[model samples]
Target: MPSRRSFLFAASAAVAAPSLPIEAQHSSGSGREMKQLPPAIAALTDRRSEAVPIKLGEREHRVERARGLLVKNRLDALVICTGTSLTYFTGLRWGQSERFFAWVLPAKGNPFVVCPVFEEGRVRERMEAKAATLPQASVTRVYTWNEDDSPYALLAKALKEAGIANGRVGVEERTQFAFADGIAHASPTLTVVSGTPVTAGCRAVKSTAELALMRLANDNTLKVYEAAWKSLEPGMTNRHVTDLIGVGYERTGFPGDASCQVAEYSALPHGSLHPQVIQEGQIILLDDGCVVEGYQSDISRSFVLGKASDKQKKVFDIVHKAQSAALAAGKAGTPCHAVDDAARKVISDAGFGPDYKYFTHRLGHGIGMDEHEWPYLVRGNSLPLESGMTFSDEPGIYIVGEFGIRLEDDWVVTPDGGDMFTPQSPSLEQPFSRA
Candidate 1:
């Protein structure tokens, strides 16, 4: 599932007629009107000290690596617009707007930026801050255009000046279509190709520092989930649990959120906007995670409000074994699809069977700076697993109208196999208990 922020934004328009409870609406209590937090949630302390932001040196190294990839991919320049890719390579956290603001990294020269003339000061300020940490903090050239001027033309001219005229230029996968089209129109001789070869090529594998941040992110998310799970009470709505998760992340000093799907809604993977109230023996599934230093963690935990029935236990065990099977098959050099096959086999053998009838979605997805990124773990993907490559080991069995059980844990590929950041959920009753 996507982040709660995105999901809620998309689901806001579809909210049901029923009003949310007071506890679900407000995260923090105000004076006498403030509702008490569950002991488990209230007891959480700030864990900001455990997180470490990515260093400028590491980002610089990433750029150098991208340059080599550019040469290998036979591209002259790479155009990166505002998004995670831009932040991943440059460490500049700029928001995307109608106005054009981009970074053009040529394979052979210092990188440059193209932005609206008025925004130069703000852009340079951030660039200077990052440059301060570099050994060679040379001033990168900036090309600015007025409100009336076409930013794409300026970008094309800048590339021409940088000796990239009439060469193959790669447009980052996420770049806006208009921007890519404008660049192509302005310079018809320039070949605009997919930059995924260079971008995903570099991001597919995690560095030691990146892994550390992801590890902390996963750890923080697990703690938040456990606290929220412990705080769950019968009669409380799904929104209450979501609010608890938000509060738990606040205690950890990280921005995070989650989506709570109850009972029948749990069967619909991403969940529904319909108001749901918790009840005894009902299934509750929480999805999404927190971001620590740009790296993200995606985890899902499914459990029962009170005592779980035999059917729920059976489904949970099958999913748990499938998750384990996928992890075991995800060794270095193994084909990515093989991992999915391993998990699907377990679910299919248990009667959830026959290709996506009950077991829905891919076994997992590659995750890092973005929740869903490149090199997915799905059927027919021939890419071989490599050490340091991280992915979600999520396998699920969804039965329409009944309930769904999905076990997800962020794991990294190892030479021998894979290692999960946290221990898997052993059973529905004790979801967070360590085995």
Candidate 2:
């Protein structure tokens, strides 16, 4: 049997592959041509046209905000390597390698970059393209080093020239240890610290444009799940359902995928590697989501293959109520842990928990460009909730020998309360509405 991770990777790759004609599409795992798609999948129409990419102005605003945050955090500059923060600030996406390529943004002056000599042209070309979209773009200085030279030394020199020789510099949270260590070694006078206060401070809150993209992503994922669920058959395996989800996303013109956990395997939070076959009265858990214009959606839905047992119905209702309780507790200014506490309490009171006896994971996680980000909704997190912060409001109950039920939807914190991007699932038999 294929490992769960490998299966998920294959499914994700299939979803990301370019769309082919319905007649030409094949199963990513089996290599068998998908000659006929389910009616629900076949009926899906392209929704990509509705998505709008993030504008250069928004990114400039983000950089300006980051600068303000850097001042507030008392950091003279922020060193951002290849990661989400890089793209978040500059709209440039570059992969990481052993060699260093970093963008250093100071709180007071223009930003500069240090990269391998061979990649300077490529990096500048991309930056130029991004700059063209701006109303009044300024040229960013580039500092290059050959393979034999230390990029960290070049970075240090750039900082020194920018009047930050001995000043405190913040390193973006995801920067590699070697890079950070090298910088520290190259310039012992400079103080290095976590840039999360600046990076997360700027990224935790969503703008109207970001929220719009996320809403579209969640909307698309929920629709794909509903359609895939409608196409389920008694004899189909979990792999078949996974394929359906990938194809559903393809038809909708977005790259997405999901993992299906059937029956007892659902008891595992991330599910088991053992192959699972669908049967009447068995529970099926589907998790994961898709990306739209750099934003992401994470959703999970659990339902029965056919008629649910009384016990299953009861568990589903308990989980559903817990989810709602968590959402209600997610008001602005409330501590992050409060939301988790509220949901855990409901499950515990329902006799399924006693503090993690049944509910396995945190209520939810922060969602945006990354599936999981800052300000997690979990126990002991004292971070206060803020408006425009988006998170997954998921609550679940898992029984080792039985089945599990999870209901997840993306929600954004508003001044008054919070709002879900997609409607809550109604029931195992009718998870999605007819209308």
Please list the C-alpha lDDT of all candidates, in the order they appear: 0.86, 0.86
TM-score of 2: 0.93
Q: Put down candidate 1 lDDT per residue, 1-435, tens digits, no spaces.
A: 345446773474257443345453443362111257678988888888988787778878888899999999999999988898988887777787888888889999888999999999998788788774432347579899999999988988999889978889899888778887877787878988999999998999999999999999999999999988888778887866776787788878877877888888889888888888899898899898898988899999999977999999999999999999999998999999999999999999999989999988999999999999989999999999999999999999898998888889999999889899989998899999886
Worst 10 residues of 1 by lDDT: 25-34
Clashes of 1: 0
Give lDDT for model 1.
0.86
Q: Per-residue lDDT tens digits of candidate 2, residues 35-97?
A: 588889888888989998888788888888988998998999999998888888888888989
RMSD from true fold, candidate 1: 2.5
Residue 341's lDDT within candidate 1 is 97
Best-matching candidate per TM-score: 1
Compared to the true structure, candidate 1 yields what TM-score? 0.94
Q: Per-prediction TM-score, please? A: 0.94, 0.93
